[model samples]
Target: VLTGFASRYAEPESQTITIVKDNLKAVPARDFNLGIEYGAVYTIKRPDSWEIIYNGTIVNSLHEPVPVKNLTLYFEDFDEFVEIATIDTDENSNFYFNYTKYGNIEQNPLVRIMYKGDGLYNPLDHIEYGGIEMGADQNWWFYDEDGDGWPEWPFTLYDLFAALQIESSPTTSDLSVYLAWMAEFNENSGTSTFDIVSNLEGLLKGNTSWTSGRRDSGLLFDGDGIITPPQSTGFVKSVQYKELVFSTSDVTKSIALDVGTNISNTIPFVTIKENVGDDWDDIMVDVYFTDSPATVYAQRSTSGATITVSIFIVEFDDVKVKVQSGTFSNTGTFAEETISQINTSKAIPMAYYKASGGDDDWDASMVTTDFTDTTTIRMERHGSSGTMSGHYYVFEAQDSEFSVQKAVLSMSSSQGYDTASINSVNMSKSFIVSSYESDRANDDPEDGALDVFLNSATEVRAERHSETSYFNGFPTINVFVITFTGAESVQRGDFTWANSDTFKETDITAVDLGSSMIKSGNMYGIMQSDGTGSSDVKSAFVQHEFVDTDTIRLERYTNNEDGKGHWEVIEWELMSSSPAVYEDFDYLLWNDILDNVFGNTSNQFVVTSWIYPTALTSNQSSNNVKNVFFSKDGMIEIGINESGYLELFLSTDLVQTTARYGIEGLIQTNEFTYIAIRYNESDVDIFIDDFWYRSAVGSIGEPWSGSVNITSGGDLIIGAELIKYSSFTGKLDDIS
Candidate 1:
């Protein structure tokens, strides 16, 4: 028996135990128990044969040796894993063990090292010598029970050392050895693991090495899950610029380009500068793209002159641009003031044109400029004055979030009709396409007089009003398409003309930004008239403004209501810094703000928060009521009632009667709602998303008045109620 001075049990210094006689009985310790009842005993015999020595070092995911201190390791027989001997690792994580055996020695043994973990490092285990069979003739290394393309056991390890996806010069043996050395430390450390096999998948093959950027190294992702040479400077996802020259005597010609599949989110910008023709300034260029063949076409046109067009194609990711194409007539007078105002809103505008309209000054040099504001686009003829008209395209400033597609169509019929089909974007999203006459060799008005219609969400039909045949040939029209996504795109479709004047009324649901984003005088848009009749393509222009949170009213600048106007509205929310991401099922308890707001007798203040509720019905506690938002016991409470309506309950001391006050169906599920409650000396007003718009008018009962005395000393819980039985499920942000 051994007795400890400090701990209940202590290990003896000597490990070898020898017994000369066979008949012996082991007795348990009585009073001097020291808490240890039954102990494991291993029979180790000394042999006269060869000796085996094993030496190894414990390292972390970074491959740096970690000091495990005085950690113990076990060596056991392979079949039954019976413990043969035990050894401890030194401060440098190095361990050495040697054992000699005779004729009864096992062929292989298992060396098991387990780290219980400390404050700084996580627990890990390593098994050496023999391997473990998972099942179905599969070993531990290649086992993937979930079939997630990656080994399920090492998933936690991969997440912990994400930067070390595939080890340096990894082979079958190298990966198996390394994986056995570093177990699942990340999951044991209680760290969140990233799903490596989600939406966009890439297959990693042999010998590929990925470092964690710790040593200033970088990686490249080829769109189809392949990797390229490492870039020493930094990582760039996408950047490509290709310049191609197309020379032709024909007025309009297109050349195709084969861009590989390495590019994701294609935003192709096409620009043209003259290479051969003296009249290069008069040439207009357009481009088209297809997905299957991954082909891009660049088309150019010039009036009768043979031109070599240098087309520059720059591809970028996440760029927003809007195209507005139309026709502007110019007087032959030199420097004639031909002012046409285009409401480009907040977008930076750039305009381009090619001569049309069969005017004598078709060959003259003309340029369009925006002088005072982006709203007005002015064209001036620098050459000798002769009446002329030309088709123009005004592009909004470069935005990082717009998806754009460009194409050109040849107007075939003698009646001037053509259809441009765009497949690059989803028509269900807010989309717009504009078309203008280009590459007609002869500047004939019949070919240039264009009126475009939104035939369907994905198709735009163009028609020239004149019935006359083309003087030279059928002219080609250029179409520019842009689709809005996320918070940037406001709404789409045709405008509904109200009986009053030329005002078009439409309803739009936007992010409740807490402030009016698309207000009057700040709204800019492009309006195209979709005529009601076959031959009714009259001029339609409008100025738009926000009537309220749900309605937009567009008043016509020209009262000629010959056709309904189709519009695409865009708004840019420019913030100096990024906003906080919305959180789910989480809360922040603030006791500091209690004294400032609810201290005085007249508790008159407003509390606002943006919340997206997944469900208003309580499925958690026995109590049906779930305090959905804010609560202060015996003072004030705001929660979802049994009927799923937001109810504001006040203490009887303040309102003189205990009553539930709220609007009908104000707080809805699955919608981001900005809720605000205000209390003055007289009555409490509730606002949902809009400040000026009150929910009191939409209430089922009459408005309730309260006394000036309202006080609460409880802590302010931002997301959930005081007792957290039933909590909010969805996301919450910007609590004030």
Candidate 2:
């Protein structure tokens, strides 16, 4: 025993020993083993700061390496998704002590800590610990069960370090994460050995939420929700273009809409702004031939003022109408004066027809798979709310035998309808409409069941009216640059060349060096002398430079532990720098997957920038397609840039691209803003806030359809091409 160590009794007796502290009881993450039934006491001093990370070592007494398959991490009795504190363990089977800063409260804020008895988590695991937060309120500040709050006595810093997760990469053996199971037994009881069942790792799987050791399963998470399953809706709408405008999106992570509001929050009819006085606000608008009141997230907003606008409607003599079977109620309103100011040339925008979200039909996806001249791919509509579903009223409508009608519905569901009566609907973009459903199959929700939601009819309708367009015009946001202070520069070591010069949002990480010329003014360039040349570079975009003192490095993460690290440069601008000059030429869609360096389906290389349009708002030239010259890797590729853009770079040399804007309902020459460029395995896709878009498979590389070779790596730059006649020239901002 150490000098100051002492228990309640003069010496700790092997017989049942009772340890008590100021009415407080807590448990630290531990390891229980069936090999040795012994427990050791770990004492920690209460911490001062409100936030603390308690670290320690929970080990199986034998102190030997245990087969990982035999280890199990789970919480108390709640066998399902155990939402317990989960962290990756370290090497040496040691728990590098580190817990959340949250305190254990006055009472015990814990449940059960268990392990597997048979050395496997499959069947069942032994309960190493079992308790909940329940103790006197007086001991709250002094007792730290999680060891994160005010630390207490008997707990030394080394004790905390022992409990932390230590991961090791053995030079000879395969790398692994280790957890040491250590337990103690009381001879007073007949139990001699403790099982490795509950190894302080909560449930391997979790409930609702996600934790490690759960379903990462092999699928890479792009953060963007899958909008469509990549199957066609079996319908197509075509729009010819003279000069297509394109916007580039972050070409990383395969462009999940969940990452951007453009995909996550698209709804029909809602505008981007409350009011615009004169200029026509670029809007993504959805329109229909029929006029009717819509139901959705409804609200009334007003600054206690009213604007006068005349409306014109033609009221037909009471026409025969059916109201829900036998119910009949004639509701009609008189037409008023018409407003002449609103642009009436392009009301309902035409959409470049393709298959995306929407469901319950054999439409596009199936039609592509089983193409038949006679088979008119069916269209489906999830009931009224617009939530998409595999099933549709149109699938129900197809059997009725009206070819044209079926064709029209199929086409409409694929993209949208177009009419010349109005203009500028593409500015609002597309939307997703969906109907919620249930885990079970009951049609209506059970009484007091607490689970009643919409059906699978969620159809995200893009181009909901640009709210600003409703006001007459949209306002252009002013652009400004953030200025840096010299005191900060001095604090940052006088902006020396070796010092990091980037002004990142986090001051703790970024440094400003005064060495390179690029470091002087904007401080934008970052160089790594440690970078690899021809035969030795580990990363396509990184240098080996680091603590070695003489090397400069631009690795994804300062340390390799990030597991998945990425580096990107961002340049934001109100407009693009692409040249405004034009040469008339016929162009079909173009794709390049041949030469660009690509990443896996999980982590991809990305680049994106934006620019305004060439034509004025009043001009009506055929600006259906914006010329785009983009290449993911070293090879050159050309294609049409629209309101939306998506590109994917995959590990293999394959590259993919996806676009939507400027094709269907887009007006001639509206400014294209907010561009993104990205790439990953499986496919690539792009988006422009409201309507712009793009999509392509990663396997198709540069000189698309001509090469199936694996893609490698290369640098990326805009406004100019790495080679040849294809390149972009436009105004840009936020260039990193």
Candidate 3:
């Protein structure tokens, strides 16, 4: 009785099935699915350029072998390796192949599973649909029992293409993200068939949770005209006791003479204090000043009672001073007064001033009183009520003096910081106003600034610099400095600088000694006259440029005779005889060179010729640079030296071999003419004067050593070797 095992044809998608192979229960731990999204770690091999051996054998339900278009073969490592297997169907689809050298599963390489019409680059890997992505060469981080950042894996999957064939590449997001996304998408797709029908025309309102207000309150009322106060517990005076109503003028008016008042606005403001937000209804105010030393006071008003009042004079920002003028003529919207006039005479004036500029930025309008011209302008910032920020700039006057065309005030359209940025320059202060109007004078600029510039002077404050009042923008109080030269430049015309400062203004006299790293867009350059190194070149040096000069040069240097500098033929100009071109002996030289060709002393003679590379000699004293050229049958054979001489021995074996000759020199009948009289095998082929003379000579597969070393006065020439036995003479020359 014979029993056969078979697949459950009725349930093709079943995860597990009992198999009866020859009446035996067969199960391999679990069930395997041919087509499914599997998340299993695998041991994959590399797939290289190759042809598919076969798509897996297909079998029908009756156990008959068939063919299927499911087997995939891919080369994941480019030209590295390959995998060939078929999509086996039914009972026995296990793949097996014989291999001793190439195709084997043990050598895990890069492989990827191709799904989308066998296209390896299918987008389904990362698509919102099916199919999974694989790794290529990146080392994946796998977490296990120990801790995070552990690489404890069975194997490191190198390439994705190869890894997919045997095992799917592990990925981040674990199984959670995939499952979550899948579940979410499925739920969104539908709960039941009827739930979808109900919301078939669902409203596509924004899935947001924000509301402008409560519509219910507008629609329904509590039946009371006024909103009843919410239930609350009673509180003490500090947090809950509201301020008693009083007039603002009443508080500051009598409080100027009286000590203090019941209102708390007089508590005084902290330095850097921003006002508490506006809706306090109670009389509450906070001011922050850096230097004001005055105490604040609040007083109840006999002047008024409905409102509470508070007042504080921030004194530090408000300095009692006047402007002075120098080096400038008074003009429209411009005034100036001399230092003597401002200090001694107590007067201020707007003057047209001309200067190179100062350390801080200086606006032409604000410099009403300019006495001395500037060598270089940096500017003085007025952080407080002094001046506006970024509105002032030093000018490189094309003429003797730069004139203020207009006093432009930065308004709402203006950008950057509000108020003024005070620079740390030491100089006298002056005040002025812009002839033009800007909506955001005391406010911040649209563009933005590092910090808010407040006018430190007593005259201007936040509301005082209103767009309507100033017309343009706010004026600036500034400090200026006199330019000075350090000891950096005495005779060299180089700029005065200490080593610590990277930036310097210098005038190059003879040569440029600047650093190699030049700024990206600066016009920094050097000039040179004609020289032996490189010809005239007047251009800025860019990065990664190779500079070759006629005089100064940088080249590869080596101490040994061989393996010195890396040399390759750029273009071999074989025109050695050109008068304009001369060999400079810069070519490589061989060392300790010696070639024994055609030397005989006893019955048989042995000869050998080999190229002697000179440049790579370890022992300098024992090295000789050999330079020779060989020729064979109209072909100029290079680097083969031979001593002019030939010797033939009458061998016992009846072997027939002879030398050939022509008009140029010796000749041969075959390709390589290494003329060797042998009782054994092949050696050097003697090609004399561009013509093959004889076949190989000497011992078989060994160096030449017959009876030739007994006696002979052979001339060992550096260019060419000579054979003393036969008295043969050959010509050779050194390559210059």
Candidate 4:
């Protein structure tokens, strides 16, 4: 019977068996069968009960079927089986359970299966067999247990009780004790057992810190479990670093940055630190980006001493820039891009034209390309043929359109007679001409001629003439004519001169002939006639004096026919003369006498003269005042006194001996002397040649009670006082 039992129970049996495939498919098939036989007491052996069969190879952790052995399996059904089955896997790690006592097991019943580890296998509890239905709630259950909502297929014991739920026997007490231990173990393990699971969940949920061993399994992290990588905002996608330096001086400086070719926004952070001997006062630093002429990130006006500036540029997309530049030349064609890259179609090609060296007399014109095609521009010197070459700058216009209008001035010359014609557009013009002629013969019949003409369609003309004419013949006839073309013009003889034997006109008026001529003494010669055989030889002298406005006195003296041909006054009369001549003099002399001009003698008196003394009187008495100017009573005198010195004196009550001031040491001979005497009530001052010579302080009494007399009636002599006493023997001028 034992042999028969052995034959039936030799193979392990179980209600259910699970074969774990550790990520392997090429595994040999294995079978585990349990056979049990009763040897005593019972005459018949019960058939193997509750047989569980697993006919597959054991797999590795990857679930692939791998060739491994001694894999223990524990099978239990808490709701159905009163006994549990435990078996060891074969070389293939496959098992079977066969129990004759129990027929086919019910479906959907609670069960537990534990994998007892072997040399190649790590032990694990896989519970919940047939009766454990996968529900939506179970999805959440796995997520709660492992903090990852992903389902694990082929449920294990850990899924049900958080621990291995294998029992030695399928009994209520065993299951209770196992569950209690599992609960205690779960309490002890805390959340650490699901750390790997949580990490995997974090990887799928986009968490930051999930690590294994020494490396991160999910997101990169620091030692403090903080996220290392930047978050995504769907707009800003990246991070970058850049270093920039700006060297600046006292003047404004600019630095260009390499932010990138394409950018939307630019945020620049600048830190400026001044070096030694650097001045930061009133220094400005700015950073920005531009896309004109070229894409440039720039910093402007960072000025100080030696300074270091750090700039952080943040660049993005969606930002735009426009650049504009120009090339200029005065004598050559310049090549430049006239179109803007930012707004190529809207760009306006522009040009500037100016005289090469700032000349305003020449014409200049500016031209631009059509708005539709502004890629290039050509500017050429334009206008009148002689217009000067000009500087030109071509660029994209800042405004919508650009154009220029100009005027031209041209000059040409043609010579015939002595006239010049000028034509100009938008210009005011003027000119002048001069001609000279030699003296002509007295008898020559040719007449001097001058003509002027001016014509203009839109301008007004004015003319002026200055002329002078003279003749060497007597009874000469001269004629002048002028003509005008317009209807408002008056026709008249402009000038005429004639003389005949019957008229015998000896007085003549002067006229302008627009030329320089010779003058005879005080008269401008008009005409002359030579003596003939019938007429006695005659000669005349004419004199003219301008007396007042429009009036002149003329005196003519003719030679008498007494055979001696002596000149005699023939006519003396007054006539009209226009345009009086102006005379200028260099010096004035007092030749006319001043008699009794001073009505009375005062306490103060001054006598002055500029003179050149030539001689001195030898018989003059030293007690008498040899006066240059003497009053009637001898109360005032300006002359040499008793001391033989040039002096000015005032006597009291016409007493000659009471002379108050006899200024001495001022007598000059043969040299021009400026002598002056200033006498006040208390003092006298003498000046020689505009310099102070001597002075005396005292009471000077009033002299002449009557009017002050000078030269007293005898034509008031100048060189001689009263034509007898103290006559000046030298030239005297400017005496007062």
Candidate 5:
């Protein structure tokens, strides 16, 4: 009987339905379920021009339709999913709603189509196909996380959607947790979303709480955490303090401090305060650092009575210190340490050279010892000749045991009637004898001798002189003895003239008197003549006739037959005097000494001098800049440009890979200016008048190598270069 009833009632038939309104077109409905309530699932075909609206503006759109299914048609509000029909798309890709006969329809009503997935779309995934007011306040916006054209609503039903997808009760009160859960849901699903939701639940339940304490206490949450003070706390990393006490008799006080660790690269802030007795005014205080284990000096005023000095150092490491008091300029010394202990090994083996006018060039001969023993080093200069001039030089081993030697000479002279000779001489070294003689009757005029051999290295004797007159008259002679040793050289002349008969205007000339060695000073000599008869006798006198750098003249007296004396022939003898021309810009060139001093090694050095620029050179070319000091081949130079700018250049090679620093208008005419240049590797610093002027970075070359033979091919030139015409036109002093 049931078979017959089934056969009599036909099976529910499926049908297709198409819905289109305005610009909205849905997928055709198919295979409608008739008997069961909410039986069929349906899908709406996405519009050909479907757009993603965000805050009243369309952010993105799909120009083509998409097949959608399992869509639940809802009425009115979004959360009220009272479905009048459940719709889905069939094989034709058309959506159909299963309409129950008792369902009611409202015209142009607000609706929200809810889509739940059947292996394709997840629940809570929905689209508003119609009834969305244009320009209305948007409660949701579309966000494309992966740029896939298909956008997801960022916060649309975000909490409910997250709960439904995660299948966990995550609190929605915390917006951060909710947003995090939404992100996890959209980007990752299944186990990933579940894990995120579980962690968020734990975070909400375990809430953050402040621990009941100060300083050492922190935040108490699911796990203990460190608490950092806010920026307003004004925290200090480290600090150091020191105090110095001084008595009425004390002129100065110092304190030593150890900053615990090396703070070489860090800048420290230092402050000092002084407190003297009420009767005394403010005292001066100075804070400084001294090497040899790196000590800090906190000094107090010397004049105040019972003063206290307070020193504060901040931003340094933990340190401890000691205080000391003493008189001014009498600060006690620190214990000496080896060079290596104080990181001064590089400064050892230091060399210095100084040169003045008329001094010999500095060379390897100046350095008596190697760097290993600085005490043995020495420097000496060949003494000046022909002039008493201001020329001196000093070279010694700094901070070492060394001494310099000087040469001293003792000399004497004698004279006779017609001959001259050196009587006796005592010298520290070998000596030379110079003599002059004149005989009128013998036809001998002024005569001079030089470089005569001494009897001994330290002492010399002159043979007794005897002169026979041609006319049976007494002879006359004169001699000069000059002894020299240890780099001392000088020139001297002695003259003797005699005549028996009255003579007139006889010209006498001296020869080979060592004129090149002459020095200007007083002249001394002797003159005598014989008388014919008692009535014919006359007084004898010597007259300085004329003088030059190399020669001098003396006129002798003669008696006439009437007993009247007159001037006779003048005698010309050689004398010493200074050379006429001495240039102010004259320079000294030390051949190839740079190579011996600074070889192809790396070095940090400073060059400093006080210069008075009296004049600028006529040459305006940059290449013709006046050189105050320089190394041959231009490896290092301190010069003035055409514009009177002081320039410094340090090169690795001859005119190659050089670093240059300069200051405009650094040199003022006729004014003394202090200039200094410090060079380390590729960095160059220029200072003028003790203030920083300019700097250059990079390209400072390697030190000149001794193998380059600067002594032969180049030189450390002062005032000018060997091949260049440029020369400094001013005075230079205290150059280092």
Candidate 6:
């Protein structure tokens, strides 16, 4: 038996055949018996690309034949490894065919097998088999588990868990069996690299019964609002907490206190002690950053009497936070302004205020009323005394770590303590209290015992004692409470720090955040201010800001001689608990079918998609950072360029010539938009939502008129360039 090739037409012509092998001679096409056991024969059409006899089998995990019968066979051409054709398998779960090999015999052939399982078996993931020996047989065993073919089930507990597909949830009530999904954790690395989703739109309840005098705990969520097991902790870690005290008399309108801590990446909370000898009037006190390191500027609205204030600063190592700080100048009795920084709807907002401008600006009683819709702050300005211009800070509130509460309590007697309950306050945490008179009644100084303290975890008590007259009146107090927890994404700590004695800048290099995970919008911090010493309280001012991701630079606006320096910094960040849409290097790749999709013609064709873009530029390590959309390298690309222009690129021979058609400011980040790229035979038109930009007939030139050969070098890629790691950080849907 011999094997060779021949012409398809039966023509009477004399043909000379040459055989290179010495042992075997070429057989005539009519006399050659191409049939062999477990093999089949086919004609080789071209010299460069030829066909070979290939066979394979499908089986279950137990190596038994997949009894479901006919299955489709996908062939991946060796030239591009793209799915070339689909054939069928026989009843025995075996397939035999003459597979075409692209390029040459030096390049191995490949086969991609995929099975859409029947009712009794789960479907198989596409398995690509390559590097087949020239003469050896090829066989594959598919693990067909017993289940409906939707989400492929893991073969063992050690297998990486992906997703679960179900037609319906269990109907029986009080079912005891646990339905759990888990990812694999690498013991050596101490991390789980698998990505999966656990979503329950329905009610999720804990175990109903705990017999034997035991009780089962309900669901628990972490600081990121992610459901976690009871044993898990490491969400929020407290580094340290420090309370600093200082005195700022009316003669000293502003004082810079040093809390000898790295105030670079921290949030500061200040409360001034009530001036017992002063009259009922609006008091303004604020904490600010100075150029001085480890120092914060404390300021009141006016200067006349002596008063003491305490600064509470918290430093957090790992927390999710958002902070917005700016000065608001208002001449009216009330003002409501929108803050774009506080964008999330899930968390509350905590605001701090300090009067700015002239001493007259501090006369009117200005208070932070409420943060509504999480983005707008309402400030109630009473007492037509002066304009209220000051610095305001709004931070995303996480109740477990820190919170600020305001309450109005009136003292009926002049010498007793009147208590009011503060709802939802954790009883086990520490508190800092500051009070001020806000009646706008008079400016006459009245001597009385005015002090406030935490009577209990949920209640606060105040005392008022008058020596000459009954100075009994209602006063508003702002309470600052801080708690430390081991299960939130916050870091709190303190360090000894001092500012430049002679007004200069101090720098802290690489604030030890335990990790280099700091970004612009996710991290915020506040620090406390304490005078240089207990006796000397001098007027001081300081400012601090982040230089980069990890550095903080502080500058002192005023000179200081001697004062107490105790500082505390609180830092927090926001984390994503759900599965990420797309990471830096993640993308999607498709077969080289752009030629088929667009065809070899200058005809009007439209391509469109609904995209929710987190960013218009790529965040990966590649030279093609601007290609944050779709790309078929060397042929065509559609993405935002480095100049933020939404452009479509077409090239005939990319190494020699290319053309680009784009529009500026049409695409934006953090927005959902419908984008369409239309080529109307003559010119190109791009539509972002209802807005369209047309490059008329001769403006940006025409789309490539004929077939741009799709080569083996690259295929169509979504979310990134073909040969690099430039990936789009967003969600995409309905591409056509």
Error at 516, model 4, angstroms: 72
Query: What is the alpha-carbon lDDT of model 2 when measured against the actual structure?
Result: 0.21
Task: Compute each candidate's TM-score over C-alphas.
Answer: 0.26, 0.16, 0.15, 0.17, 0.19, 0.32
What tens digits encode model 5's per-residue C-alpha lDDT throughout 1-736?
A: 2575474555789999965321223321221111111111221112332222111111112323434555556543334445565555444444433222222223223344555433422343334423222111122212344554433322122222442353433453443342322112221112111223324211111122232211112122121112232222111223344556666666545655554523331122221212221111123233454455645453433354444444333321111111111111211111111122211111111111111222111110111111223222111212221111111111121221111221222122233212223333333222221222112222111111111223333333322223322123122211122322213233233343344432223333432322112111111111223333322112122233224433544333333311111111111122223322222334533445435334456345555555566676543213444544444555655677656566554455333333334445656766656566655554455666523543442343232322221212245654554343345655544343
TM-score of 4: 0.17
What would the per-residue lDDT of candidate 6 be over residues 1-736, giving only the tens digit for each residue?
2346644545587989964311111111121121111111222324455544334555666555554344444444435445444555557555565565566442233445455666556665444334211111111111223323111222121111112222123222121132222111111121112211232121111111111110111111110112222332233222322223334344223343444543433455443433222221223445555555555555555554344443444433234444555556556655677877444422233334444333222124435344555567655544445555555555544434355554545554243345667765544333332323334233321212234455565776554332325443344434333443422232112222243342222333344343212111000111122322311112222222334544543333222322111112224332224422322244444445445434444244455555555555434323333545666555556666544556555543212123444445656665555566665444456665533455422343544544333222256555556344444555544344
**Candidate 6 runs further than 4 Å off:** 1-266, 271-326, 330-333, 339-376, 396-406, 412-417, 423-426, 430-437, 440-450, 464-473, 478-736
Residue pairs with backbone atoms closer than 3 Å in model 1 (clashes) = 318-400, 319-402, 320-399, 320-402, 332-385, 332-386, 358-443
Tens digits of per-residue lDDT for model 1, 181-231: 211111211212111222111122221123122122211111111223332
Tens digit per residue, CA lDDT, model 3, 158-223:
111122343322233242221111000112221111111112121111111111111100000011
lDDT (CA) per prediction: 0.40, 0.21, 0.21, 0.29, 0.32, 0.39
The CA-based lDDT of model 3 is what? 0.21
lDDT pick, better of 1 and 6:
1
**Model 4: per-residue Cα lDDT over 1-736, one tens digit each:** 2674474435666797777533322122421111111110001112433323322345665655444434333334445534355555555455444323254344333334455555445565444332113211111111222423212221222222222343332233333432211111111211221111111110111111222211112111110112233322211212222334345444333444443433334333332333221111212233334554213232332243343333333332221212333443434222233444323322222222222322111112111222234454444332222222212222221232211111111111111122223333121111111111212222121111121222231221211111212221111111101111111111111111122221122322331211101111101111122222212111111222222322323222222211110111111011122432212111111222223332233444455444455555542323354535322233444555434366444443333342434344455555555455555553445555423434332453333334232222223222333322343444444333
Model 6: weakest 10-residue lDDT segment is 214-223
Candidate 2 local lDDT, residue 407: 9
Q: What lDDT would candidate 1 get against the real structure?
A: 0.40
Cα RMSD for predicted model 4: 58.5
